[model samples]
Target: MANDLSLNKEQILDAAEQALKRYGPDKTSVVDVARALQVSHGTLYRHFASKAALREAVTERWLRRSIAEPLAQATGLPQGGSAAERLRLWLDTLIAAKRAHAAEDPELFAMYAAVTMEAAEMIDAHIDGLILQMASIIEDGITAGELRPGRPETIARAIFIATSRFHHPAHAREWNAERTDRDYDSVWELILAGLALPTA
Candidate 1:
């Protein structure tokens, strides 16, 4: 149908994301997105029932891009490395993503907050999966004697929360803004110290 050809769901969602990125959730409107995509408001509504629905979709898309896909990619990496090494790489990747997004689009941080509060369960599930992945790496490290013996899931959950909060721009504005190589090195040292086996 010509109507379907006029505005696909992907385009509408993409436009919503761009709008959120540019103006944040509070300022972004369905009409604005429609205008940005050069489509009538009706076209957007045809795909999304309301502005809130569009926002939810946009938030979901953002999370998938920032968190889900990265975790999935990390899963496929060869599993020969020590758990500490894998965890370090994963944390570094996560922190870098937060910092890059913060510097690239401040509004995205705002949008993240807005959507997170609105869709806590969905966001929590995604985070839980990441924690499980981290736990798996920790267990691997323990088996290799690279890390101290302990419950991997508990440790992973603690590390995930601690690292996430520390890197979260919403909570640690100063740290995120001032993150440098030295900062990253310090974080890695702390994480390794907590999990690594003592040197002889």
Candidate 2:
């Protein structure tokens, strides 16, 4: 019975995600999800108290699949390359994942932004840990003389914020449309230039 209930919950959440993507969060409702899943409203409510709660669950699931999974995979990649190379690869992987997901379901991007604003401290902590892990990699580069000597945490925070600003549609639209990749490459070059060691 427990397993069956869990499966039902998963199905309902999946249905909710599809509905959100199609109708958007503001327009999506429990009735819409129930109709999509061919389940009764009572059954949907059995898994989630309300549409907002279900939306949160859907957004959380999307984050787990889209962001957490890719980060985990990147962490498992070979780490022997130059620190700068590894950092670039890691950032590129994250950016590519975001771009792909946004292309497939732009509504999901809006959902993520909303959830990030209202999510609990635990969620924020997890995000912080991800940032810190990236910073640790940059610190390794600095120690190896592949990057300049400075505060790794600060540098990491700056790069994360800067890259996010450049790639996020909210900010990127202000810049040239045809030159997004150029802008990204330039930003990365500037970051590396600031951090790379001066050859003797």
| Candidate 1 structure quality by residue, lDDT tens digits, 1-200 | 23446677777787787787778678888899888887778877878887778877777777778866897578559576667767877887777777777677777676676667787787788688877888888888888888899999899988877665556545646654456567667866887898889988
- Candidate 2 lDDT over residue span 50-140, tens digit each: 8768877887777677776777667657677888888888888877777776666767777766666676664566567667767878888
Task: Give the 10-residue window scoring lowest on summed lDDT in candidate 1.
Answer: 168-177
Candidate 1 to truth, TM: 0.78
Each candidate: RMSD: 3.2, 3.3
TM-score of model number 2: 0.78
List runs of model 1 lying over 4 Å from the truth.
Answer: 5-8, 22-24, 35-43, 78-80, 176-188, 198-200
What's the C-alpha lDDT at position 195 in model 1? 86
Candidate 2 stretches with Cα past 4 Å from truth are 1-9, 34-47, 118-123, 172-176
* Candidate 1, backbone clash total: 0
Instruction: Evaluate residue 42 in candidate 2 and report its C-alpha lDDT on the 0 to 100 scale.
Output: 77
